[model samples]
Target: MSENNRYTLITGGTEGIGLELSRLFAKDKHNLIIVARNKERLEKVKKEVEKEFNIVARILSIDLSVNNSCEEIYRFVEKNNFVVDNLINNAGIGSFGSFHELDMEKEEKLIEINIRSLTKLTNYFLKKMIDEKTGGILNVASTAAFLAGPKMNIYYASKAYVLSLTEAIHEEVKDYGIRVSCLCPGAVQTAFQNKAGIMKNDKTKGLMMSPKEVARIAYRDFKKGKVIIIPGFKNKLLVLGNKLASRSLGRKIVMHSNKSK
Candidate 1:
């Protein structure tokens, strides 16, 4: 429980929001164990972060979509005797298109990464934190979690699960001196948009926040023990609007936004 021994473990930390969160944590003098799929990027991030932050940065190069990936990570850190004070379940993927026509293989992989791995990893680390009686967890969901996304069905549903699970866990573990938070940012300018084939219309472009800003707000609010952290005013408004509207209307709004020009 000493400062030197505490580490924040982040998944998909080589790029995008995960990378930004890694930087923020490092800047605050938190040691990091960053996991990602690319070896080169991992090495680069490790070197840069350690040099810039004057803190230890460990790297793990493994794809989270594969089976047993979360267990592998747990074993890796346990073998090294790293104490993960905070667990950031930031690794997730998305696919675009109608549900029926989308590739089932990719959809399954998405679920594995976004849902199964996150769940397993949290279960592994959260137990340790509970025993220790101090820790934090930040699960990155999306504003899309508030409504049904037409073209991006599976991805939205997966995030909804994240939001719901994190909320319930926050209540469950608050008495244990552990903090659990759900980050629900709207449109972030990151590689995820391209990978998800999210064609930003004029409206989405206007709503988009940089990864740096989103990560800044997320880390700040997470430290405050905010259960649901929505990064921007527009995103908060969007979620509120969704809550105020009927489920059918919310679905139509998302479907219209997803339509290609």
Candidate 2:
């Protein structure tokens, strides 16, 4: 079957939650344009998803941390005349360290990839979604967004920005039939922790949600126009508790998490 003109553009779609989300979208016969830095991984995922779901999948290798990467991606999509019906800003990075101990250059790239790229991509496609008045945006925030993460401090702050932005835009564009959602999932079974210098703890594994499970809930909730999507039931409760907890208690909790885990 010929693929539809409309496509879902997912950043960081080569693996983890982004990859699972791609499968979900493609299962419905949607065309996809997946962006990731590793060309080999992107091509592999493209071929696998295309064959498994019998849908067209395109790969775009771009480092979202680079300046103007979002602009470059936007231009590529426009130049190719792909009708982006959905935008999934799932590309992000995390740093695990004290604010003073981390390298500033890496921290800057983390912010660039996690915050700036997401905002710019949304800005580029938001108007088009508004004009079409039939699609949505899913910004992948995290459970870290609710409170200050002492160890992964900048990463947490970046997610807070994502959740805030998604909520504000969700309200702004709801009347125009454009859905916006912030996905705030807790720890997931991905290479994120390893990449971020987090040591594996058996204690955390029990709490971790699988990428596919998180993706399923995220996709379902976003489709239903839910503004804040916290995947697991325990995660929802944690977010609630974080909001109600005293500031000192929250700080102590996160600080302990940093020192121990």
Candidate 3:
């Protein structure tokens, strides 16, 4: 296939970091297959990017949290003959509150979106890329992966799994010329906070990074085949700080940070 024909597939590509990454990839002349739950938003993004970048922006409207949705995405690209040269597993959701008090259904869907679908999609595309002997996978994790979270328990745990899985795959696939990188970003100014039940007055407000900035840095580092891409310097420091401290201390810090002052 020609370089011009290669496509990048991004999940949750209608908003937040995923949306920013779409613009960056499109700016570089990469064709895109963006998957999101909202058909209206997806169509709007597709129209805008296709017109601005002069590249194809195919949109797939599907809820990744649903059963077999990942398989449906794989089939969509295959049927349309879209060669995904890069797969961005960027779809994720968070639920804040005590684990016991949280809605079980939401938590289940969170696991389905953040973990199962990501793993499934990665598995599907990684095989194709390996056969072609070229491709990249960028899994969006978070700094929360480094420490235990209190009120935001399941989300942190899910991100930790992403971090670990991506790191392991990065090592395993480097020999095959498949660049696998995990993007561990700090708090970003996006709908994620509100959706996660995080209040406006939260402490992370001071550290919030813009989605565009995060996506720019992420695209740069991922293209470099960096195994772990932490967007902000302060976020890097936070990860390092957690490592230097005891695990229990790190948990306590996260717990305290979870509270609004």
Candidate 4:
């Protein structure tokens, strides 16, 4: 497929970092395909982006956590002649409190959306990218990926998988000129806290960077072909500190903070 005909497909592209990232791609004049679970959000973003950037914006509304949704998305784009040359797997969920106390069903849904769906989409688009011998992927992970969090265990582990998978694929496909980047931003001002039922912690708020800032950094670094892109200086330091401390110590600190909230 030719470059001009391909699309930069971003999951969860209607809000937060995902929405900001969509804007960046649109501003750069890439034809876009953005996904969201809500049809209203999907249509709004499509029109909003298309108007501002004068780029083609196709919106898909589907719950990615649903079984076979990723395959459905792959098929939809295939039928539209839209090759996903730039895939951004940004849809994810998180939870707070003790793992045992957290709702099992919700946690399971989080895993399906955060890990399973992302993996399926990546694998689906990867085959096409490999065949074309071009294209890139940016998987939105989190700074939590570098540490084991006691409260948000599933969320952290899922992001770790995303980071690990992207790194491995970055190495595996560099020879084919297929770039894969993992974005690991720290706390951001987004609906994620509300959706995750995480209390509005002042510390988290203080550390938060704007979603637009994170998106700008992610897009820039991804283009430079960085395997892991952490957005801010403070976040970079936190991840660095995690590396310096003993794993148990770092985890205990995270657990205590969660319990305090």
Candidate 4 global lDDT: 0.90
lDDT of 4 by residue, 139-257 (tens): 99999999898888888899999999989999999999999999999989999988898856566686689999999999999999999999999999999999999999999998987
Candidate 4 regions with alpha-carbon error over 4 angstroms: 1-4
Against the unseen true structure, what C-alpha lDDT does each candidate score? Answer: 0.91, 0.90, 0.91, 0.90
Please, what is the TM-score per model? 0.96, 0.97, 0.96, 0.96
Better of 2 and 3 by TM-score: 2
lDDT of candidate 2 over 1-261, digit per residue (tens): 446678999999988999999999999888899999999999899888888889999888999999988888888888888889899999888889899999999999999999889988999899888888888999999999998888888988999899999999999889998889999999899998889888557677867999999999999999899999999999999999998999789878988988897
TM-score of 2: 0.97
Candidate 2 Cα misplacement greater than 4 A, ranges: none
Of models 2 and 4, which has the larger TM-score?
2
Between candidates 1 and 4, the one scoring higher on lDDT is 1
Q: Write the per-residue lDDT of candidate 1 for residues 1-261, one digit (tens) a residue.
A: 123767999999989999999999999999999999999999999888898989998899888889888888989888988889999999888889999999999999999999999999999999999999999999999998888989999999999999999999999999999999999998888888878777755456665799999999999999999999999898888899888999999998789878762
User: Which has the higher lDDT value, candidate number 2 or candidate number 3?
Assistant: 3
